[model samples]
Target: MSFDQYHEPVNELSDETRTFARMIVSLTEEAEAINWYEQRISVEKDKQAKAIMQNAQHEEFKHFGMDLEFLLRKKTVWRETLKAILFQNGDIVELGKEGEEASE
Candidate 1:
């Protein structure tokens, strides 16, 4: 989807929500950059750059999905609506704190 499709006027959102919206916009831009890198690697004849770009793109996609989830959860919507939107994908669990080890 185009950025224009998701773009809303700043005045439409409260100050705190506007901050979150800016983060979403920034993340979307980063995702697009990663996508462009992936395409570039696909066309380039170099093998090493292609592998690097592929890995980078995967990481970027993960971050993008996480950011989207974070922003959606912060919105003042019904519980059912939130569940419906994010259900069947996965729960938005947080990672362990710094220096903390995984329990599993």
Candidate 2:
């Protein structure tokens, strides 16, 4: 679906809604990490780990989408969420530093 589909009406959200949105985003981040670990487990020959990871991935995927919707409901930008994710991990900052060092 388009990003616009996630747009939440401004008046519909209260402070609690904003707090829930932030929580969902946090959960999404954790799910992403779990999903990554599951992928790594899938690479191994352990059938049990693979199955567990597969289930976790599916749940996390759903949670991520729902959380995105929650943020949109709060009139928050998807790009802002993305930026928050990246900035929280220092990815953007590290990339910027790498770019500057490479140009020198």
Candidate 3:
């Protein structure tokens, strides 16, 4: 079986690179779970079920955040760009453009 997460041969990658790839995959899965829970909660008729889904979705959010933080710590450029883009009250596109420019 092949893992799509790897673009190159697995044996050629360092242990740290493999772990990063795994964390990236995990982050993607958590985001997908959050999306699924959002849809389920939206249509759920039972309040208790919806509440449970919300709780689960919150966990996904935390997982996503931690995964992102881990990746950011490993990537200075990415962390720098996001530092400019996140938690700022400006035009998002403009901020992104600026972030990209500033990184360069």
Candidate 4:
């Protein structure tokens, strides 16, 4: 089997590092699926088909969120930064800037 996600030699990396790389790749794939569904839904002519795509997109969103939370749990700094940036409404860039400072 191909471990395309690994930039470093698989034998040289720790098990934890390998797992992290796998999850990172999983998260990227989920994000791409969500984007693909979005584009397909936009051009879809049938209302029923569009609704089905929307439902599938929601599943992808959940997968992406779960993957993100998993990664965040592993990286404390990222968790800290996103805790500041997520769930609040207002200038996102400003919040991110504040989060980057807060995480340090």
Candidate 5:
């Protein structure tokens, strides 16, 4: 209901840009859900409740990954940068710097 995600006028933006913004919001919401579930699971007294929260968290994680993949598919430089940094065994900061350079 809230159109708070857009910094520009909605009428001025293309459909693709609007969809991209919506997905960005979705990604953020999924991340927040994951975090909330993590916090709940950490302090939950009931094992069953914790298990349910964990399951829900897993779903959120999947959504987050999917949303990220969608956005990455839309941006070539972002995809290239992440490829340089992700799944690599090295200093993260260094890898990030390398990724930035590689993308350029």
Candidate 6:
């Protein structure tokens, strides 16, 4: 397996950091899978194929959310920052600014 996830030497990183890297990779892969499904579903001729892709995409969404939650649990400031921005209706840029300030 390629160890491209580690910028630093893998031997130098702690176990927790390595685990975090793996999850980050997993999160990225899940996102990619979701995007691929979206594209495929959009052009699919068969309704059944589209529905199957949609179902698979939903699974990717769950995996992405789980990976994000795991990372957020490891980083308190990140969790606190996102709380101000996520699920809130407002100017997204303003909410992002508020999240940054709140995290600080």
lDDT of each: 0.64, 0.63, 0.95, 0.95, 0.95, 0.95
lDDT score of model 1? 0.64
Q: What is the TM-score of candidate 2?
A: 0.45
Which digits, one per residue and each the tens of the lDDT, describe model 3 over residues 32-78? 99999999999999999999999999999999999999999998999
Model 2: residues >4 Å from true position, as ranges? 1-21, 24-28, 76-104
Give a tens-digit lDDT track for model 2, residues 1-104.
Answer: 22222358746668686576566657668677676967687586888877787777777777776766566566445444454444355578676555445444
Clashing pairs in 4: none
TM-score of 4: 0.94
Report the error of model 2 at residue 50, Å: 0.4
**Error in Å for residue 86 of model 1:** 6.5
Model 1 TM-score, all chains together: 0.56
Question: How many clashing pairs does model 3 include?
Answer: 0
Please report how far candidate 1 places residue 9 from its true position, in Å. Answer: 9.3
lDDT of 5 at 40: 94
Residue 56's lDDT within candidate 6 is 97
Lowest lDDT 10-residue stretch of candidate 2? 1-10
Q: Which lDDT tens digits does candidate 6 get at residues 3-103?
A: 98999988889999999999999999999999999999999999999999999999999999999999999999999999999999999999999999999
lDDT of 3 at 22: 97
Output the TM-score of candidate 6. 0.97
> Cα deviation in Å at residue 10, candidate 2?
21
Which parts of model 6 have CA positions greater than 4 angstroms off? Answer: none
